[model samples]
Structure formats: structure tokens, C-alpha cells
Target: MKKKKAALLIALVMSTCTAIAQQKTPKAVMDQFMDKRFGMFIHFGPVTQRGTEIGWSRNDQVAQADYDSLYHEFNPRLFNADVWVKTAKDAGMKYLVITAKHHDGFCLWPTAYSDYNVANSPFKRDIVGELAEACKKQDVTFCIYFTVLDWHDPDYPIHNPHDTTQSKGLGGNMTAFKTRMKNELREVITKYKPFMLWFDGYWEKPWTTADGKEIYQFIKSVDANVIVNNRLGKVNDKLDGDAVGDFLTPEQTIGKLNMNEPWESCITICNQWAWKPNDPMKSLKQCLQTLVTSASGNGNLLFNVGPAMDGHIEGRQVKRLQEMGAWLKLYGESIYGTQGGPYVPNETYGATRKGNKVYLHIFQRKDGTLSIPALANVKITKAYFMNGGAVIIKTDKDNYKIELPATLPDENCSVIVLELNKDAVNIPVIPVKA
Candidate 1:
């Protein structure tokens, strides 16, 4: 009788633990976001007309007066949200994020809170609303990129000596600026219902961590499911370990291998965020390599594209996107929804895993054979090229040697899928020499 009672107690505890483990927690929203490993970032505004980068150009390249007046002539007659969304869809991107408002203090959407919006510009069209509707129509998730540093808002408190006249007429109260920002965010959330809000320019004065937390909480109060980026109230743009934002936003650069928290690398397709006339763009190989590297690091990639002044995506950019889509079509299994490897990614290659399968991404196809050291504990039941065809893998003690065909499966990167005996993987983290 005593033995039977003990057995019953153990079963009850095991069942309870399993139920608790399966319960949805507060981190579910972030987990869902990490699952979407790739997204598109559209950077478009009046600044594209001058063929200069947005926001920063007001300080160096173009006079604030000319930069601000570009809106007067801003008319993107060729603006087509459907085509833009289609291009994103073709690129196998799960979401589309556009600059609803940039640092130049220009609002692409008609916001009742400010007159410095599309309502007063020559465009006179709701860019945000159109893109939101298009994303919904095409079944792509929609997000908004909003900047806290507004150069035109009356409530904004920041003042640069170079643009004293442009900064004039605005109330210089920090309290008023924060309130206006919150109110504008409320309007955006209620109107667009964005899946995420990618806030930028919070490193400026008057933007505090407390302020970032407040806005983040306010956003959750409006919609608990929405994700926020760490740029909100980032202290000097450094990563805040305890920030209220959902994920860390490392801009313009990728990081070393890290899966501690969900993070994203937001980089441009070309040199500039906004379209520059005849700008040298990244090659198809470079773009694919970026995606693989990001995935290997267990992070998402927000690839940026700057539309022309006429609001049309460049043919060259579109072609590269299409090519990337073709590559993803063949080997997306190794990317989307997969977690970073048990092994830390190195320069030559990286790894991703899903269930009992481990994918080795070979970036450098210099030799016809690839050798991965010190994976003795991992038992590979079968190995094959992700795209197609056979792969010969030999395991000797802790070493894994994969012999590849002379002709590579993909030109940019190749993926080798290995079926493991166990559902979970255990890889030793090799410290970087540098």
C-alpha cells in the first residue's frame, strides 16, 4: 500500500509539472516574434526626393530649410502599396515595417496631433494606412517605425544650434514632448494596429529609461500583444538588459553569437537608409550571407529598402529580393522557425536546429569538403543537402567531415541537414580568440 501511494504521488507531480511547463507565459509574444526570423523595412519620405539619406542629412548635406521644404514638393505619384507588399511577399518576408514618422519630423500618415504630416504635404495621402491595408490584404504582418526625435513638432523640446530657426515655434517643455509622443503613439496603435512598434532616436536628451518604460507600458495597456524595440529610452543607444522593450535592436551591424534574449539586426540593402540616386547596392550573395549569419546568431534581420522619390522600389533592389526569395524557396527549412545551433557560429559556417534535425550552413565553399570539429556527442543518423542530392558525412571520434560535390547546391550558401537521434542538441561554445 505504501509503495502504491508513492507511485501515485510521483505521477501526480509529473502531470502538474508538464501542465505548468506548457502554459502560456508573458514571454509568448516575444517568442512568437523570434519565430518570424526575417522581415522587410521600408524607408521612404520627402528626403528621398533630394537623393540624400533621411534625418541626418538635415545636419550635414542639406540645409534644414531645404530639407524641411522638400515636403512641399513631395508627391509620390507612383506609390503603390500593393506592389511594395508584393515585393516583400516575394522575398519570403513575414512582416513589413515602414517609417510612419522619421526623425526629420515628417509623418507619412495623417496624424491629428501634428500638422507636419502627409495631410499638409503635396502627397496628401495616408502612406501608413495604405501600407497597413495592403499588408492585411496580402496576409503579411504590419509594423511601424516611429522616431521620438521630431525636428518639426511644436511640443518637441530638443534644439540644435544649426537649426535654431527651424527649431523655433515649438514649445520647449520635456513634459509636453513626452505627452505628445504618447498621444501620437496612442493614435498610431489604435489606427494601424501594428504588430510591433520600432521606436528610434530615443538616445537624445529628455528621453529617459523611465520615459521609455512608461511608453512601453502604455502601449501594452492599449494592446498587450504588440512588441516594442529596445531603442525606446536606450541609454546612449546601448543595450538595456532590463528594459521594458521586447527585443534588442542592434542597428546597421550584426553581433556575435548570442541567444540570451531575442534581438534583431536592422541593416540597409545599400549604403544609405533612404534612396540615393545610383547607390551601389549589396550583391545577392552578400544579402543571402547576411540572412544566414543573422539566423546563425539566433537573431532576426530587418533588411531595409529605400524607395525612390516616386515611391517605387528600384529595379535592381527588386531583382535581388526576387533572387533571395528563390534561394529561400529551396532552403528556407534551414532558416525560418529554426533556433540557433547548440554550437556557437564561427566565420566559416553556422548552425541552426529544429527538432531532431541540425542544419549546417556553409558560407565559404572554398573546398569540396567541410570539416566540423568536436561534435562527438551528437549522433547523425542521416545527412543530405537541404536543396537536394546526396551528402557524404564521416564521423571519427569528435570530428565531423562532410564531403560535398564539386558543383555546389547554391551559389551563395549551402545547407547540410543532419537528422539526429535526440530531439535536443548539445554543442560546446567555443570562445572567440579576439
Candidate 2:
């Protein structure tokens, strides 16, 4: 009996030690990603100004051959890497992720893989190189976006043999394809080391099964600390791969991340990935709220902006992004270095908390006070405009109310801070799924 008792005590001690270690474990890398609430997603290549999608000139009513050949003719005389970096910084973006190579197989920098990059083009300068250097100089985290599937590579497999333009990662020699893909991947990793690697087009035909795993392992061998998205390839089960990169990145939309692990939502300012002469961009208010809403749900937003052919951002897009930066500058306390609330508000509002402070973001502000009826225990101490630094709050017994101000500091949304001594004790989050 004594021996058994000793064994039990030892087991308890080990368990306690393990629990303490787990709690004390520092999530540094993950924390850095979360702290940087905003980043710039660039989708610019030789195909811009041609008025066609960068990679899909073949069947998408775009000049496939001419679009592909634009790399040789590529020369952004007005291209200013510093200006781009400055714009992103001014817009509250802590990081910038650019497309080193899109699905069209046109390389932005000189690569030994093929003669289809900037080296062969009229633009003798290396755009990605300049951008990487600029980002480092400006204290911005740099990331690269590479298309796993290429449409223009001659060896690339295509179902329709007669259609030269439609061959987009359709049918290629698996062995040769893997080698060439790895070569480009190595070039990107070696030439310009990045904080994140956002991979796209893995869902195509041959990138699945063992081929996908092979590429995944190949990537890890080079940069194990690099973050990768779950969209590595298509699997029968969940979006699974060799787990080459860190983080799961979602494109186009935002909502409650249904994945078990960490995830992010990357959306665009306009409809197309490449900059169009006239494209409807998301409004200032929409961009601002979208960011906060995404953060509130424990996910990051990689906002995209496609630059014009002359290397200039659309004024409309720039204006809105700058506005977003100004708004973040004011209410950034609730965003940067913050974690997702255990209970998120539904339609009208959402919740994000850091340490002792819980930020009450009013997406849809009511007249006098926003009623947080569900938050029975939360005593409202102060409410203020995030952009202008003005306190606005009202309380009455157990029923605390939000006293709104007449003028809105931000044209978009309002950030309200609810000061409380303690957290909402055992509060049930009522997500309006309507």
C-alpha cells in the first residue's frame, strides 16, 4: 500500500510540473503574428495594366501569350519600392507580403529556373529584391506569396493538349514538375528570406497525395520556422499536408474560424487580384470594421492591394487604407497584442480582451446606449472614440448603458472601451447566427 501511495504521489507531482510548464510556455512566434493585426498583401506582376488577371490571360478573356510575355516587356519606370512600403506603414500595416511568383510563372526577380523573369524583361531591375530591402529598412516584416501551380510552364500538364493557354498546373511530369517547383522555391527562400510564406493554387490536379507531401517536406528542410497555410493541398480529410508552414490562411472572406488550429483571413480591397484601371474598392468604413471584426474573432486579416502597371497605388485605395491606419492609430490598444475573447458578441457587436481590459467594439451603434443585456456582471466604467480619444460611457445600477458622442472620430466604426474590475464571470457568448 505504501509503494502504491508513493507511485501515486510521483504521478501527481509529474502532472503538476507538466501543467505548469505548459502554462508558462511562451508563444512568441504566434504572439508576434497576432500582435501585428494588419499586413499588406501585394498581387502585382507584369500582367497589370494589360487589364487582365496576372496569371489567367489564357481563357479568362486575357491575352495569354502577350500577358505571359509582358515580363520581357516589363518596365515600371515609376516603380518606387520606398513609396509602396511607406504607404503600407502609414496604413498601420506591420508586414508586407508580395508575390514573388504568381501562377503565370513570371518571376519578379532574376531566377536560374527559367529565362521568364525580370532578367529577360525590359525592366532590368529586381522589384522583389528592392521591396525586401525596403521592408527591412523600414521595420516592416516581409513575406512572400508563391503560386504552387503554374499555367505557363511548358512542362506543366494540361488536359487539353491542343490548348496551349489553358494548361494551368493541369498535366505535368510529376518528377520534373517537382524538381522545377523546388528550384523556384529555393530561389525565393534563399534570395529573400521572409517572415511568412503564403502559398496558393495547391488545390490543382497533381499537387495532392505524395507530391504535396514531398513539396511540404522540401519546404520545411529550408525554413522550419516559416509559417504556412492549411491550403497546402487537397486531401480527403481536412486540408492537410506535411505541415510545412506555420498558420492556416483563408482567402476572400472572414468569419468564425472553424479550424482547430490557428488561422487567418486574407481579403482584397478590390475584386481582382491585379490592379485594374477602374475597380470598385471596399469602402473606408467596411475596411476598418472588417479588420476589427476579424481580430475580434481571434484571426488576422491580410488586406490586399494590387498596384497599377506604373507601380502606383490607386488614389482611392490609398486614401481608404490611410484612413484605416489613422483609425488603428487611435484604437490600436484594443487590437495590437490582444487575444480573442472567450465569448464574442453577435450581429450588433463583438468582444476582444487583453489582460484586465475588455474592449467592447460597437459595429452597429444604437442611439443613446448600446444594450449589452447578456453582460449582466460587466460594469461599464468608460466609453470613448478610438480615433479622437474622447470618453463616452453611462451606467445605472446593474443595467449599464453606453453614452454615445455626437461627433464620430472615425467615419467608419466606433471602438468603445468597457472598464471593469473583473472579467465577465462565466458569461455566455450569444453569437447572433441569424
Candidate 3:
């Protein structure tokens, strides 16, 4: 009897621990994350001085020696964390993710683990710390972008652009390198308390599946509520990973419609990840359409903006973000706290849903008429434009024909609200016809 009791107690304790671990990312936390459909991704580092790509340009476009030494002369006198956070707020971004450490092994903070950080540079201010504080003041969630591979670290196996002779397969102590990475990660978590950690550079050969799992578990151990992306392990072309993480990340493209798991699309406002002079910027129409499609596909959009060397986002980029904010102001209810719709996104239109209402976002139309496949069990009781205009909807056995007005409220994307008798989300997802 005593032995049975002891075994039972041990089993109960183990079960309790498992439950605790599962509850780390509570439903409320995930709901909040999903609700924040839009965020800002800033890729700012010493590479901004050269107006080239952040990490990839180390040896290809610019000489490795010149690229690495740029930090020594780095001094962004105009950098104001408050201004940066405010810019994001004005652009209707609910969260912010900044590069704490890029693949080039340059640290944005005064990390005790490495001397290759902002502290050693001419600008000694803690960029990460200041941004965290600024995010708090602005009521925005602060997140960190950290790379798994480091070119400058002696312990890491790979030294590609920096040393041409030394390949990734070269001899190095991965154990020591992992230990240093853990220490730096712990420091960043403790000091900044970021809500999310956007990891990159996991595609490198040196980083393995075991490493991804360990790092993910370690991060959870530090802060159970923190969110991590799928890039922690080996991922496919779509950026879907096999290891553990809170969400999937589709870089440079919008993710496909997937209600089974959480995802976020990371795309840049300009052509390059880092700031470049005379870079062509995306128009307001393109920006809003991207946001609409991502949300309609049941995903978030992490739009990126590379700040200039002078510590200011290019004037045109800022203006484009302001335009996005303006559009959100008028029709935010169609986006915020809403789920992707029964109508799948297509070239012409997409949809989002909240409770009994489905928002149809029409990007293009032919002769002011749009056709959408009808939901099997759902009935549209009333239909109207989001901005105070009546819309005519004719429902057939197969589809619904919406007659749009001659003049749209917004040319980029016009939202139409459909009041359903039942909850819109319960309806089966239907595809749009060509």
C-alpha cells in the first residue's frame, strides 16, 4: 500500500508540472497576439551607414573589413526612441520588433557577454533598452529580433564573408558558442523583458534541430509568456519549422490561409531590409492591400522599415505609414479583434469576420460588380458599405453578386459589411471564383 501511494504521488506531481508548462502560453495571451493584426519590424544596425543590406552585404556588396569596422564610427546623434515608437503608433502598429543582434554579430545593447556592442561604439546608449522603455510608454508591445548564427564570434563554426578560407564545416567549439548565446539571451530577456523573440539565421548548417529545441525550451524557462517564431529550427521555403514556437513566419511574402496555426508575414516597405538612398517605396494602395490580404488570410502583417543612418526613418516611408494609419482610423473595426472569413482571399477581394458580421474587402472590380461564393448555411440579412453607404447584394444558389457604387470611399480597398443571421466564423470557408 505504501509503495502504491508513493508512485501515485510521483505521477501526480509529474502531471502537475506538465500542466504548468502547457499553461505558459495561456489562451488570453494568444488571443491578444492574434488581435494585434499589424506590427512594425525595424532592421537598423551599423550596415545602415553603408546603405546596403544588413548581413548579406558584408562581403558581396561591401568589403568585409569595411563592413565590420562601420560600427566603430557609428554615432546616430538624432536617434530618439520615443520618436521611433511614436512613428509606429502613428502607422497603426500595435507592436514593434527591432534587431537586437543581427547575423553580423553586432549587438545593439550593452551586453556583458560581448564587447562588439553599442557600448563599445561611439554611441554608447543602450538601443534595445531605450526602445523597450519607449514601447512601454507608448503602450506598444516590444519584441526582439535575434539571429542564431554569428560571423564574428570565434566560437561559432561558420565565418563565411569575414574569412573566405574558413568554411562552415571548419573546426570550432559549438558547446562554448551555445553557452555564450544562452548567456546573452538570458541577459536580453532579463534586461528588456520583450514580449516576443523573432529568431533568424536558423537555416545555417551549424544550427541543428536539437539546438532549436534547446533554445526554445530555454526561452520558455526564462519567460513563459513570451512568443517565438517558427524560424527556431530548419524550415521549408514557406518558413514553416519542425521545432517548437508560438507562430509561423513567412518572410517577404504573405502567408497562405491557415486557421489551424498562428502566423505572421514579414515584408519590407522598401525593396531592401536596410535603408538605401533613392530606394523605391511601396505606394499606399499596395500597403493597405497587403494588410487586408494578410488579415483576411487569418494572419498578421509585420511590416518592416529600415531607419536611415541619421537615426530617422526616411520621410517618404513615414508618410506611407501615416497613410496606413489614416485608413485604419476610418475602418479599424473591420480589422481589430476580427477573424478571417468564410470567403477565401483572391486577386479581387478578401474577407474578415467578427461575431455575426463578415467584412468583404474588395481590391478590384469589373464594371462595379463583384461576385463572391455563397456560404452554404449562412444567410446575409443586411449589407452595407463600412463608410455609411448602402450596397445591393443579390444571392443565388452558388454565389452572391455585390453591386458596388460608381465612386468607392477608398480606391485602395473598400470594405463591405455583411450581417449574418448566424456567426460568420461558423460558416465553411469558400473560395472566390476568377
Candidate 4:
């Protein structure tokens, strides 16, 4: 009887230890990712030469034969890793996540596992290596974006109609495919030792929860400190709490406020993820607002920049980023190293908190006064504009109001810094009227 009891206790202890290990990411790595709320996403591939979307334009925009033949003509002599990392740095971005491999199965780095890489192109340079070195030099975290669904791989279970060859179908050598992918990933991790692995295109037919867990474990084995996203096919950005992977990636969309899990909204500066002629760009104000919203929601923003065929970010796009950077220079305090909330964001504005201060981000300008519901217990000590000017604050039992400047603080989203008596402010949830 004592032997059985000892065995049960041992089992319980082992399970508890396993659960703790799985739940906790290396604090240093997770803190680095979470603290850096803004990052740069570079989506450059051979498809950019045609001024079309990567991977998706196989048939509609360009013929499959033409698409496959792009590597022969691929040349980005002007490509400079230093300039790429500098662009991100100038924009106040703390990290960069570049496409190591897109769904087109085109690898940026020369991979022995597959011949479909930049090594075969006219460029013949290791783009990933160059960029990783640049990022390290610039004190920027380097991460890679890898896609699981491959249109070029014959072993990949799913077949897009645009592909020149059809797969043997669902029962295709999935085990071999996974092995090849893991091997390639091992090469990347072992070589570059990336800050994080941002995965996408896992919503395919062949991928399963078990596959995600296995891949996640494999990555952990390689570098226990490296961060991984939730797109490993096990969980998604929507599901929080016990979701597998380090962070949630809500592609092209901003996450809701009060998110319990770490998340990032990957959005494009222009409409397309790849370079195209005359592509409309989001305004400087829109860009800052997006970052503000993401921070207010306790999430990160991986703003994407698609480099041109010549490997240069367009002058117009560069100008927009610099303009946004200028704003961040002045009012970045409302963001970086802050936690979201104390007030749920409405269409009008959002809020972020740091230590004993709560920052109210006013999106829409009000003439005389700006008011929002407040927690009854917490006291608002003083209020002032982040850029400049002091304001009178009034607090009632259930609401707080601030006096606005005659002209709103810079045209974009103006931040009002409020000193709080305590570190925590509970923002009471108010139900929406349908």
C-alpha cells in the first residue's frame, strides 16, 4: 500500500513539473518579445519582381511557368541588409521578422534540404544570413517568418490548382514532408539562432494538433529560449489560456482589449504584402493609431514593409515610416514598456498604463472636455498632455473628465498622461447595447 501511494505521489509531481515547464517560457525571451511592442515585417520574395503578391499569384497574376522561372532572373544587386535593419531602427522598431520561406516554397537562405532557394537565383547571396547579422549589429531582435503550406513542394499534402504538378493527394508522404521541414528549421535555428519563429499557413488539411505539438517540442529542443507563435496548427490567435505556442498572431487585424495571451497584429503598410506599383499606403496618423491601439490592447504590432524588386523600400513608404517615427519620438511613452487598460477602449479613444500612471489616448478631438467612465476606487491625481500643456482633471464617483487643449496635441492620436495613486486600476466592464 505504501509503495502504491509513493508511486501516485511521484506521478503527480512529474505531471505538475511537466505542466509548469510547458506553461513557462524562458522569462528573458518572453520579456524581450512582449516589451518590444512594435516590430518590422519584411515580405520580400522573387514574386516581387513581377509586382504581384507572393505565393498567391501563381495562376491569376502570373502563369505557373513564369512564376517558377522567376529565380533565373532574380537579382537584387542593390539589396543591403544594413539599410533594411536601419530602416526598421529609424522607425523605432525593436525587432524584425523577415520571410525566411513563404508559401511559394522559396527559401531566402541557401538550404541543402531544397534547391528552391535564393542560392539558385542570380543574386546567389544568403539573404537570411546577411539580415540576421545586420539585425545583431543594430541591436535588433531577428526573427523568421516560415510558412508550412508549400505550393512548390511535391511532398506537401495540399495542392493548389496553380501548381504545375498535383500531389498524390492527402495520403502523400506527410511524415517525410514533416521530417524535411523539421530538418530545414533545425538548420535555420542552429545557424541563426533567431529571436522567435513566426509561423503561418498552418491551416492546411494535413496539419493536426499533434503535428503542432511535435513541431513546437522540436523547436524547444533546438533552442528552449526561442519564441514560437500559435499558428503551429494547434491553436489560433482567438483562443487564450493554455493555447500552445508563445504568442498569438492575428494576421492583418488588431486584437481586442484585455487579451490574456501575448499577441501581435501583423498589418501591411500598403494593401498588399508584396511590392506593387501605385499601392496605397496607410497615413502617418493611421500608422500611429494602429500602434496605439495594439499597445492599448496589451499586444504587439508587426508592421510589414514590402521591399521592391531592387530590394529597396520605396521612398514614399520610407517617408511615411520616418514621419511615424517622429511621432513615436515625442509620444512613445504612452506605448513601449506599458500595459494596456484601466479603461476599455471605445471607438473614440484607448488607454495604456505604466506603473502609477494611466495614459489616455484620445483618437478623436473634443472641443472643451474629454470624459470616460472610471473605476470608483482609484483616484486620478493630475492630468497633462504628453507633448505639452497642463490640464484640469475632474473625477466623480463613477466618471472622470479632463480639460482639453484649444487645439488637440499633434493631429494624430493625442496622449493625455494621468498620474494615478495606485498601480492597478480596475476598468469596470460595461455591456454594449445591441
Question: Which candidate number has the best lDDT?
Answer: 3
In order, candidate lDDTs are 0.82, 0.72, 0.87, 0.84
Q: Would you give me the overall lDDT of model 3?
A: 0.87
Q: Candidate 4: where is the Cα deviation over 4 Å? A: 1-24, 161-171, 239-243, 425-434
lDDT of 1 by residue, 92-111 (tens): 89899999988888899998
| TM-score for all models, in order of appearance | 0.89, 0.83, 0.94, 0.91
Per model, state how many residue pairs clash: 0, 7, 0, 0
What candidate 2 gets wrong by more than 4 Å, as runs, is 1-27, 159-171, 235-245, 257-260, 342-347, 373-400, 406-409, 423-434
All candidates in order of TM-score, best leading: 3, 4, 1, 2
Give the alpha carbon lDDT tens digit for every residue of 1-434 in model 2. Answer: 99999999999999975554323113477668767878999998888858676676544666565566677667878888999999999999999999988888788888898888888888778889999999999999988888777767767675332365654534457678679989988888878997777778776665664665566667766765566555555542243344434566767877573324456778999988888878888887778778887777777889999999888888888888888888877788887766666446455666677765677777765575665543555544555555446565455554446666665444466666656666532344444444
Give the candidate order by descending lDDT: 3, 4, 1, 2
Query: Which pairs of residues have clashing backbones in candidate 3?
Result: none
Q: On lDDT, who's better, 1 or 4?
A: 4
- Model 3 lDDT per residue over 7-114, tens place: 999999999876654444666787899899999999999999999999888877888799889999999888999999999999889999999999999999999999
Number of the top-ranking candidate, with TM-score as the measure: 3
* 10-64 per-residue lDDT for model 4 (tens digits): 9999997676456546767776788899999999989999999998898778888
Deviation in Å, model 4, residue 197 alpha carbon: 0.4
Error of 1 at 320 (Å): 0.4
Summing lDDT over every window of 10 consecutive residues in candidate 3, give the lowest-scoring window: 235-244
Q: Cα RMSDs of all predictions?
A: 8.3, 7.4, 2.5, 3.4
Score candidate 2 by lDDT. Answer: 0.72
